[model samples]
Target: MSPALHRRLPLLATAAVLVGLYASGGLLYDGFLSGRVALNLLADNAALGLTAVGLTLVIFSGGIDLSVGAVVGFTSIFTATLVERHGVHPALAAAAALAVGGALGAGMGALIHWFRQPPFLITLAGMFLMRGGAYWISTESVGLTHPLYNRLAAYELPLGGRLGLPVTSLVLLAALALGGIIAHYTRFGRNLLALGGSESSALLMGVPLAGTRIAVYALSSLAATVAGLVLALYTGSGNPTFGLGLELDAIAVVVIGGTLLRGGRGHLLGTLLGLLVFGVIQTALTFDGRLSAQWGRIIVGALLLAFILVQRLLHERLGRRRDPIHTV
Candidate 1:
């Protein structure tokens, strides 16, 4: 394989795995191939998709944000409390949550850059702070009965027959499309990839290191906040407990999507396929009533391992062929 093709092998593998899972599900379950079920998979995992997409950008820049899940949880409860308790408009509440998330992300990024700190430590502290702040706001779940929420909860864009796309799913698809464009076609995206592949090389090439690092984290937090909003819309309520450990899920899906966990080459399209793989496992387990949820976890774990190994091999191959001056 060419060096470029080697970079894309994991993405191809992910697509093949998704197709196999869908085929197996169709064979095993009565309604597995239905359009509704397919769309439901997307709808059910919209928040997760959003989070993973955001994390994708960060990972592409050779960074990790452990605070994504906490941000989601905080945004959900923070928005809900504003709408329910403080009589704040849902739109306004959402804006506030996004602002807070972006600020937190930028702050973390600045610390990582200016203080020469590791992203892991800075983001870990951020995770604890946000989670604790969420608990401080409300220990209990806050229900949302806003008219806007009601309308959104009930709204659906019908395709044909019994098939319809929910708002959350629509958002997920839109974000995926836009994310693909941004990741591949934009200068910022190139800078991010370069940074992830090798930061020293990125700086040597005059890629604005400080701005890219700070902006990527801010963008990731923004995505996470949007995910929290989607989750709130999906569940019609928000709890401080929402999105517990979801950062790990986002990371897993990104990795499974063929994005190198070490940073550098990957695609948002792969992340979508990875999320589908995740949904397929959950849906298949649901179809197979005899098996417990633990089985789903086991299956996911196995697939995650397989993908990681594939990535490792690809990395070795690329390392051998890569020019010393151009790491990406």
Candidate 2:
């Protein structure tokens, strides 16, 4: 395969898997192929989709963020407390949450870049700190009764014949579009891939190592905060425990989307497809109505493992194909 084709294989595989899953679901379940069902998948996993977009950026830069779920939970409680208790405008409260999330990510990134600390360790510490902060703000779920939130929760765009797209889904799509553009069309994105491929090479090629690292984390955290806001709108409440284990889900989405866990290659569109696949599985399970909810996690775990193995094999094959001795 040509170099370009090699780069595209994972994405192609992801799309194929997603399509196959949808086709199987449609065949197995009555009325499972409707527009409403499709729309609901996006609506239900909007937050996960958005967070995965951000995580895609980090992974592209050869970094991992274990704190995404905690940041999301913290933002929910933080924004809710500001709006409900302090009587702050909802918009302002959201801004505050975004700022805090960005700051937290930047701090973690700085530690990773400057101190040469492990990304996993720094982000793990960050996860604890943010989760603690959420509990500090409020151990219980805080109900959001603000008019803005209520309006947003009720907002939907009709698609004819009892089908509609929620505003949250639109937000997820917009985020995906923006992330796609950044990852594919911009210099920063190119540098991110380069950094992921090899940090020394990227630095030698003039990639701003420190700045890019910080920016990547900041963007991830900002996306996490936005996801939290969407979750708050969806649930009409803020719980410190919101988004529990979502970081793992977001990582799984990225991996299933064909992004290399080691980084340097992937597509935002693939992540979107991965999210759809997850949603389709969940919907299928729901339609069955007999399996326990834990089955969803079990299936996802198996899929994640399969994708990881595929990625490892692909990487090894590509490496060998590029080796002059092997080619000869």
Q: Which stretches of candidate 2 lie over 4 Å from their true place?
A: 323-328
Q: How much does each candidate deviate from the true structure in C-alpha RMSD?
A: 1.7, 1.8
Residue range 172-195, candidate 1, lDDT tens digits: 988888788889999999999999
lDDT of 1 at 180: 85
Backbone clashes in model 1: 0
- How many clashing residue pairs appear in each of the predictions shown? 0, 0
Residue 233, candidate 1: Cα error in Å is 0.5
Query: Model 2: per-residue lDDT, tens digit, 135-223?
Result: 99999999999998988888788878887778899899899999999998999899899999889989999999999999999999999
Residue 267 local lDDT, model 2: 85
Best by lDDT: 1
In model 1, residue pairs whose N, Cα or C atoms come closer than 3 Å (at least 3 residues apart or on different chains), thus clashing, are none
The deviation in Å at residue 1 for candidate 2 is: 3.6
